[model samples]
Target chain A: MVATGTWITQPVAFTSYQVTLGRIALVGLVALGLTAVILMGELDLSVASTLAVAGVVMASIDNLALGIIAALVVGLLIGAANAFLVVVVGINSFIATLGMLFLLRGLAFVISDEEPVRLSNIDAGISFGKPLIGEFTPRILLFIFTFIVMHLFLTRVRVGREFYAVGGNRQAARDAGIPVRRRIFTGFMISGLVAAGSGVINALERTAADPTAGSTVLLSSFAAAIVGGILLNGGRGSVFGTLLGATSLGILQVALTLSVVQVDVQNIIIGSVLFIAVISDPNSIRAVSGSVRSFLRGGSVLSKPSVDPKEATNNG
Target chain B: MTSEASGEATTTSEAAARTADLGDRGGADPDIKRRKLHVLEQMANRGIFFFTAALVLIAALFIDGFASLENITDVFHRAAPIGIVAVGMTFVVISANYLDLSVVAQVATAAVVLIGVSNNSNIPMAIGLALLIALAYGIVNGVAVGVFKANAVIVTLSTTFIGLGLLRWASGGSIYFGPSDGPIRSFGTTEIGPFPLSMIVLVVIAIGLHFLLNRTTFGFLLKSYGSNRNATRLAGVNTALVVVGAFLISALGSTIGGFVLAAFSNTAVSAMSSGFDFEALAAIIVGGTSVFGGKGSVLRTLLGVVFVSVLTNIMVLSGLGFGYQQMAIGALIAAAVSVDALARRAAGK
Candidate 1:
């Protein structure tokens, strides 16, 4: 019975292997740019909106080739704006991205005129976007390519190391001759650009540009990032973990969906998983020996503050 | 004219004396400094929006029926539901521990529970039952975050889904109400002395919240924990209990808002409040409750509720549709939160 239990519990034995892989590829690609900003210890709430706008921009261009190009350029511009606000204007990442969220959502609505815009022919929409190049889903291909390039850039490039430095401790990074402001700005830009790309992809998949679509995903993204073990304090997590977090969450949701569970139960289950992950020490022995090992290659640690609410009240 | 209206409202209060401290930079007699900080704090969090000075200016100048007593009552009436919700949010926001996003879900769910239980009879009992359920739901939210030590964001968010799902199931996947079309309809419409009874409920909630936030030990404890929990614990406070208790209060706020809606809307609909949680959050943040932790006020939230209502009313009157309103509100919340952060960094607080 114990042997059977272990066999059933092992993820390898789980029939959701395909779903997990698919989610990992899709969500990982989307989370990559966000990983850049998070590494610098900043939160970008506007990425989802950026993605939506980029998707809409792609739709307008019509030609698939141009659509993809338009999405990237628009994403870059938005990213630049996000960076400018956070690094130069000194707005906190949260507020800055939030502002960007409004601006982008507004632009989307105004341009779309509060109407859903789509390619009239479904095949035309997917012919360019959905084709698998000899077996690899385009999204999967894009995901792999993005992950590889991003991993290389983050590890091998001069600027990539700077991202780590700034995120490690902004003050220390500054002291070590990093252009802290510039790096931080660059991080926000990446956040916007990546989200834009992802949003555009989402549009292509659904064949519609929805201005309001991104808002619902914001908290989930945060939950994923946190569960993947990225620290709000910064400098302690990896893109790999974030990707893993997204995949794990996405797959878990799919698995729940396949079961007869109600939406509330699904939510309860996912919420529990996220909560446990957030509070549990990242490097508990079981966790270390578990799947987290394959992702980061190193280890994890997070300290908790000791206090009861009443004592905290009295002190304040 | 807006100033005159305020002057009329505050002829008897000391709040009138402290109104313009914003102009007095570097006036740091601790008392004055505290007062100025208080005003600025209110502005950053929620008060500025509620002030209606801006609303009055626009309405007085741009709107044809702006200053009419009828319009005044209408605006207050509109502000009532949001005010009640905001009153509860102020408690949660100030506790600096948890944020309750499940109110819309509660309201929707409770609306269904109340109406369904009424079984086409004893509507008041149904409304009362809904209030009881709202209270129970609040306890659930309180327990999930407080006892579990869960991240309030995820917990509340999921709770929202849970509430929404429960509502759908209870209603059998359809909205189960029609025109409150009866005496209960007046719960939302009845007015007294050029003022709305709904607004009266809002005002009472606001005053009650203010006293709870400022004039009590529990309030002080919440503020203290919000500022620094570790230090608070070291000082011997039961930080968890305080947070739990804070959630309980937030739940009560949710119940009041939900119960009122149950009485007024007379129908419980699925996905009826899909956007409500976000709007409440936007209002709370716009009112100036830091998403991070610590520092906010009921008065500011009151202002926020009014500001949002008037802003919506004006935008609708001006004929800009819901799309622009959303965009504008997003901008407003972002701007409000940003300015608050900017002030904090400047003040080194």
Candidate 2:
């Protein structure tokens, strides 16, 4: 998709493609955290809201270090609150985080007074986004470093692998003596921390914190995670996949801009692609095929319920 | 070990003796006590009612102009649109299909289509076309979620983008009804003996849906399906049809809401209903509908809508801005669901 869009632009500069990586890094930072939480069979819809809240905090403070620390602490508290709701209070992760999303979004608006907050140290903020080495800015380096560290955590760490175990089967994991709740709590905390970091980077790049900044990024991060093969069902996926997903999405956006495609049209394309990706699940595929076969065989089209792959395999 | 075993035996025997003592005293006394306990339990179960009542009392006492009849009517008028959409959302949530995030976009489509088509054609035709488009959206969403068994949240999210994008591209951003004096505008603003027409529509729809949910076979099947999908399917219920029906009702609600909103504003734009979907969902969840599904009522949703609208109204009257209102509502959703979860756990559900 990127190549085709770039091909139409006449001068297909590789440099433009490299520039797109910076945007991908922004998405990657958030998506990496999302990937971790999803691996634990939980969703964190509050990531974007937390990002906005953190960005607003970062923007309000005059000193860079203090601002970043305050932002991280805010993110950590929000994550801990989500953990208390989901892990301790036993609310569904999706609903709890969704509630947090709304609360944080509202808090962002309240703190910022529904207006954009410009960073006090404009030069420092701008420098963060400036390329330091061969098309890699400080923000991009942070994202890459976070991705690498997350990759190692999930792969090499014992506690990290237990997130998969907990998600795959909670009862069985408990029976096996895994600290399931603790793992989930840790996952959300890291997710919150990483999302805050992403917010800081975004504010640095833009030099302002807008109350509505994270609204669009919320869905985009999900798209990135899903497109990179992170199953919504959890107990599977990797940060590496999210990185690739973010990269492709960034490239697609860049390509569309290069080809002068309208924003609405771009949305249509992206939505359609997401729809296709969601339905392309193997379980959905089998269900579709089974229904088609039954229809062809003159059996009742809607009679047979869609067979759950996990259940079907278990039965077999 | 022996002492612990004897202690357990003693506890059981003492409990048995107490039961016998109660039986010996009188069945009537126990029955009255049990009845009182049952009433207390019922009240506890209806926690949302108390929460809403508390908010109303607080608002009435603290906020100026809150206790007035005009402000009360204004609250209902404000709630009408969300109530309409949330009534549909009740079914979707009860059926365990989760949220229809695309309703926001579907609403915009209806508004845009109504104005655009009305200007090009006739008003009635525009209404029909707008509803038809919404129905098409519902069908696509229903098939994806019901037939293909895709995740409801993601499927609806995708449809939101698709619907919004298509509407924006076709309408070229915004469209106007192009007339100041029309029947549609009157329909939006009309009042019958101090009651807004939209509020009446909401009430009628709510009553109709109450019956549909409590008295109909489809409602029974929908509830059962939500409670346990595999069990419902095993019982030969067309679970997919029930889900599709739920989505259809939701679509119908969105379309009607759009029509009302557009008529009131005399213009249609993609951003008009931006936060409406979440607002409706919040009302539904706040009204004591279990997010887990299989149990809810349109009546509860009605109270929820009223509660949310009243709270926002009170905030406005008290010099609070939209930001504070959003925060309060957001906090309410989390608190409501957390309380529900705790109650469910206590009940050992």
Candidate 3:
């Protein structure tokens, strides 16, 4: 950020930082939900589209509170529908969510009539959009609060621990008498609820609901979550890591914007970063570190260390 | 420990006994009932074929211009590129790595490369360069997935974005128009007695792929890898090679599809083939190809291609907007996948 500020004008850098931070706070909310679903060995590609739907719903409704409630309800319904297709109907989560992604995006387009819905009332918009403190928007504060609550919920709560078990191994979790299906169902619902919250925040921040708003959020949020150390395969990650990841991405975006890099180039950079992050994940890091240590100890890194079953069994 | 061992042994023996009983019942009164269920499952597996035939018949009976030879030919022409891509996708899916989302990006890249290169070079050189570019992209994906064991969806998805970005950057955000005087253009525009030349190319490619998949040892290894990678590896198959081959084949198909599409439209735009990967996937899934891998047929994908084409044609004829069309496709994808899941469940797979 200092480099960006130095490269560009300070005012422009500050504005870019503020805008990117605000935008990614909303994205961070979605990423938090995505982290949970991904940790549970499932994916919800429809989060972005669900956000679009919520945005549209919130934008279309006259009453602010009513719109917010409606959007949340719509999100929950979408989540339930996804759970039904995945858990009850037995469709693979990837395929089911992919379908939902398109379905919901299309629905958003239909609902919004392919136009951006602007929030007409300034007072209500200000309440949601204005910063609660200096340089900290309501959305950003909500994001931080949600992050803390979710962190506690996942780390401290019993059901949250069960989510780890289920994601780590569904059969094992089932054998252990966990309500695996219900846990998975709830994970998706939380994802849905968070997605809707982000959508509302987005609508408020922009003071309008654009039908195409969330199209790019899916990949960006995934990138953020993955960079934050969330495994795509499931069962390990944290909201705090995701918070840092989203912040880094926001900073990266701001930096790129200041650098005048084209959007396409920015996409390439993001894609590369995501690839690198996934490849250099914790397991990979451990393997590399072990091999390096072995090499330093004057042992051939490629040579397999002989293992005694007795020793292994005793350790276990 | 002793009790746990005994408990596991008993469960295994009981399972064995149950299988023995099932085998015995196969020749008894239950056999007929089982046979009926088997037949039902077969029908469900072939549901899309039946559905397509029924849809065509219904369209013929009801919709205007639906039964016309000209319109039918047009549908086939329109289906050709995606069908070709779907054929390749069938292999990738059957290999159990799931869908290749990069195909659309590959197609666009191929198209742009073909046009951009052909402008400065000969037609043959341009085509070769475009294919080489696509093959390189395939190698990158294959190595990352096959060698590094990266998640297929994430890797391919990242590649998709990267490919799109690189193509856009390279092209300077401009669309490329194919030159008028080449085999590529002729292939795109020419027809052979009521059929588009491109459709004929699609048929030839389909036949070739069917032979490769069903008649070759390589195909067997590919399917085996998809079914059980560990077992295949234990059986002395190079699983990485199989995976790489599948990705290459997928990229090859996308390249061809891109080339044909660009030629047909006489233009190469960065986003022209956006969402095509999903469309090919839909066709592949609709054709009864298991998304989980180890079971699928190119012929089934062919049927799926036609089915989707006819459905889209009918929808467009009915004057449905793009939004509704997207919704319908999504619903179709969900329905097709659900049917597959139901069939798999019924079959105890």
Candidate 4:
């Protein structure tokens, strides 16, 4: 909160807290979905783009009720498509999502004709863009709801455990009789749905759904997952970690921007952190370090029997 | 290294295939894999060139000014960054690790640091600080990748954001310091002859990288390290150092690229190299470098970058507009990546 006067600072602290709350509500829910996918050993760069498409679709609809349903349906369909390709069809998650990203972005550009879609709405004497009750807005509520739901799904549900197994080790998970395919599908779908929900919130806040909404968020999501101490290769990240990641990222950007640091430098810092974290991962380092020692000590070909089919001749 | 191992294993499999005494060996799994690989290898060797050439031809027919000397120079020059980036990635890929996505940000980080420091401080001190910061970044990534052994993609992706954000924050998220900055200007306006200085820089880096990859024990070890990382380790090589060194080299490439981009713009921006990763990566993959690592070439990457640059130039000149441009380029990337993936399968055979 950065307050020298503590809670006695009154209005200033209150505004800061409200702003933070507003940011979390807007970004946290989708980040939660992204956390799920990352936990399953994948990155979803297209989540932002997914949010854009779903929000645009919802905003474009005539009836609010039908629009909400349509958005969810579209999100599910897109998620399913991604899951089918990535989890089931075995396409690399990043590439598959990359394609989806371009496709969705292009579609957004086409539909919006490069214009932002403004959804007109207001309730209880407050505009959609403004905070309700000191930033305890509907978006904030949705964020909390999504977080609790995902936490439950991941921790309390059988399906969630299966998701972890698939990420931890596909072969072993299969060996243990896990329905790997379904878990993966669900993972991707969850990613899509939440991203879409994030998009809806984004649209509501701006009152104008941006076609490029998720175009830039790819970096943010990755930053969140990594800084939150979530491992990229799956089976090692947490939703809470993602929350922290998203929060820290938001704070860093805001703090830097507010301080006279230029915005671009902020980007560099985020990217650099991600890279460093990746390189310093323990398992990867051990594997690499162990290999170097082996290569030096015995000059024997290091072979993992489960994987290496070429070890015999490589030594020679 | 892994290629050698895989190559040897395949030969054995080939022998087994021959010994089986059935032409329908193609009917079975290994045989099918081999058959597929045979096709892929053929594509890797020559098909890549044809693909690039054909893309050039298609651009010429469809795009105006596409075949001009000006266009050719522009295309090649534009590709220089990716060419440089690919040279670094080729090492990492060959070493059986991941390519550095943070490279995209590294370019900007280096440029901004180099230009920013030079603009603000004494030249030597600025240069020293720039290099110091970049090396710190490299070590951070290297330690994580080499010491901690994280997946290259996530690590680099995270750093990409950090680096880009840092650059923007430092530079005010805008085109910075324009050509007035002398040291930064060299990265852009300098030239050895009719060629832009950036092109010459590309040539220098390419030659150096090629030498590093093709002629050195380090290169062989890198290849070995990637192909069968375990085998290389068991062979008692310091796989950690090698992998870390791979990141250092990749960062070096990004530094060079940053230098050149600084040269090109005479100013640095946060998004200067924003989309360079996919471009460099596309070139590497399109050049027939394996996404799974341990099989690709710089020459092919050069060609791949040239091909992409040429295609983009042609598309721009042709005036196909934005949507068509994106669609066509997207299609091309997918096609190239698909081909490269297919080639890996072929090489596997």
**DockQ for each of the predicted structures, in order?**
0.23, 0.34, 0.28, 0.30
Estimate the lDDT of model 2. 0.78
Candidate 2 interface RMSD to the true structure: 7.7
Q: What TM-score, to 2 decimal places, does chain A of model 1 have?
A: 0.79
Judged by DockQ cut-offs, the docking class of candidate 1 is incorrect
How many clashes in each candidate?
19, 0, 0, 78
Q: Which lDDT value does model 2 have at A16?
A: 90
lDDT of every predicted structure (CA atoms) = 0.64, 0.78, 0.78, 0.65
| lDDT of candidate 2 at residue B221, scale 0 to 100 | 73
Residue pairs clashing, model 2: none
Give lDDT tens digits, candidate 4, residues A251-275.
Answer: 5555555556654565566566556
Q: Per-residue error at B293 for model 3, in Å?
A: 0.7
Q: Determine which window of 10 residues in candidate 2 chain A has minimal summed lDDT.
A: A307-316
CAPRI category for model 2: acceptable
Ranking by DockQ: 2, 4, 3, 1
Each prediction's TM-score against the native? 0.80, 0.89, 0.87, 0.78
The DockQ of predicted model 1 stands at 0.23
Off by over 4 Å in 1: A1-24, A62-67, A80-103, A120-124, A162-165, A259-265, A281-316, B1-51, B65-74, B97-99, B120-151, B178-183, B285-293
Ranking by TM-score: 2, 3, 1, 4
Best-performing candidate as measured by TM-score: 2
Ten-residue stretch with the least lDDT total in model 1 chain A: A299-308
